[model samples]
Target: MKLRILGCSGGIGGDRRTTSILIDEDILIDCGTGVGNLSVEEMRKLRHVFLTHTHLDHIATLPLLVDTLFNDLHDRPLVIHALEESMEIIKQHIFNWQIWPDFFELPDKSRPSIEFQAMSAGETRELQGRTIEMIPVNHSVPGVGYRIQNDTGSFAFSGDTTTNDTLWEVLNRHDGLDMLVIECAFSNSEKQLSDLAGHYCPETLIADMSKLRHRPRVFITHLKPGEEDQTFQEITEGLRGFDVVRLHSEDHFQL
Candidate 1:
């Protein structure tokens, strides 16, 4: 399995893009503004998109992606997978004709350009050659993290979550996890704001991470633009025995 960092920031501006990861070539973990960096040729190659939540930063580029590649998707269709609530938000708020031309209805309603498939947490769905499972996580909205595995190895992404029990337990339940991509959105100094926003700071993340049974190479992602320096510094000092690295846009990993 190959993973590419499309965008991995808490907010957008400059070169910072919100969270979006391309798995192999067919699967996308999230569809943020970072997705715009991909050309029409690259967007055409995408078949499946898995969203973390309904937040604009995470799902912002999805509607545009459909509109940009609508005419070219002759036999190819994009499947947007997430919880039912997330699906509803996209349909009602984003593609409801007011905000954007409902591309799913365009080129004809009989054969839509996009499809929404709702997934329940803990439900394992097969995509390409791997098994992808959604796990519930603590967030402001109905959010979920995912664990994806092929025959070679498995990788888990904790999408926009704060300290919680279910996330730690599910990760420990899985025997061998190659990489763990978790978020530390703010610094330890901003613990109050972090908690209110339902994201993790360094201290909170460290406390929760201590419960994990496996020691995978932990990569920190989703730091706010201005807070990047301090948050990365804190994560480096906090997580010992785990190879910690802050994710950058061009980084790639194969498992």
Candidate 2:
């Protein structure tokens, strides 16, 4: 399986994009602003989207993506897999006609341009050869992380979470994890804000890292725009034994 990082910043600025990841060419982990970097041809290849939560940064481009591909999606609607709560928020706040046209009922309700498939924690979905398992996590809203595996290897993304046992426990059940894309959204100076916002600072994140038994190639993501360097330096200093790297947009990996 191939993994591509479209965006991995906590906030956007010049060249910075919020969270979004593409698995191979067909599946997307989140529909953040980073998706805008895709060309029309690349967008056409998208078949599935798994949302972590209803945060604006994580789902900002979903509505625009559907609208841009409306003509192409008539026959094969974009399938969105997310928690029921997340979907409900999208329906009420984002896709609502007042905000944007509800594509779920657009192009006629009989065959819409997009579809939502609500999934629960612990549930797994198989698309082609990849298996995606949703694991619950603590966040400001209902949230989840995903564990995706194919025959060759496995990787997990800790969507948007703070210190939590569920994410570590669920990943431990798997045989092995080749890579881990996790968020450390703030620097130690903003540790209080990080906790209130349901995000991770280096100290809190390193504390939670102790719960995981596997030592995968760790890629730190979602660092706040200006504080990226400091936060990453702290994470690297604390997570000494593990192979840790700061994730950047457009970086790709093969597993």
Candidate 3:
């Protein structure tokens, strides 16, 4: 499987985009502002979107994406896989016509342009050959992480979480993990704020890292734009034994 880091930032600024990850050509983990970087042709290839939550930074471009491909989606609608609660929040707030046209009912209900498939934690779904499993996570809103694996290799993504045992426990249950895309959104100085906002600072993230058993190549993501240097410096200092790398937009991996 091939993974591309479309975006990975706590906030956006010049050249900085919120969280979004493209898996191969057909699947996306989140549809953040980074998704805007894709060409119309690239967007057409997308068939599945697995959302971590209903946060604006994560789902900002979803409405636009569906509207842009309205014509093409009539035949093969885009499938949005997310937690039931997250799906509800999106339906009531974003797609309620007041905000944007409800693509779930657009072009007629029977042949809509988009479909929402409510997913529960611990459940797994296989599309083509990839097995995608949803794992519960601690966040300001109802959220989940994902573990995707195929015959060749496997990987996990900690989707907008703070210090949580569920993520580590689920990952340890598996035999092997090739890569781990986790978040440390703030610096040690902002530990209090990070905790309140349901995000990880370097200190909190380091403490939780002890729970994981596998030694995958860790990629630190979602660092606040201005605090990126300080947060990553602390992570590098604390996680000395682990092979951790700072994840950047456009980074690609083949597993």
Off by over 4 Å in 3: none
* Per-residue lDDT over 135-178 for candidate 2, one digit per residue giving the tens place of the 0 to 100 score: 99999899999999999999999999999999999999998999
Compare candidates 1 and 2 on lDDT and give the better one: 2
lDDT of 3 at 188: 94
Model 1 lDDT tens row, 25-117: 888999988898787888878899999899988999998888888886645678888999988888899998899988677677877888778
Report RMSD for candidate 3: 0.7
Superposed by TM-score, candidate 1 places the C-alpha of residue 25 at a distance from the truth, in angstroms, of: 1.1
lDDT of 2 at 114: 96
Sort every candidate by TM-score, greatest first. Answer: 2, 3, 1
RMSD of 2: 0.6
TM-score of each: 0.97, 0.99, 0.99
Q: Clashes in model 2: which pairs? A: none
Task: In angstroms, give how far residue 86 of model 1 lies from its true place.
Answer: 0.5
Worst 10 residues of 2 by lDDT: 234-243
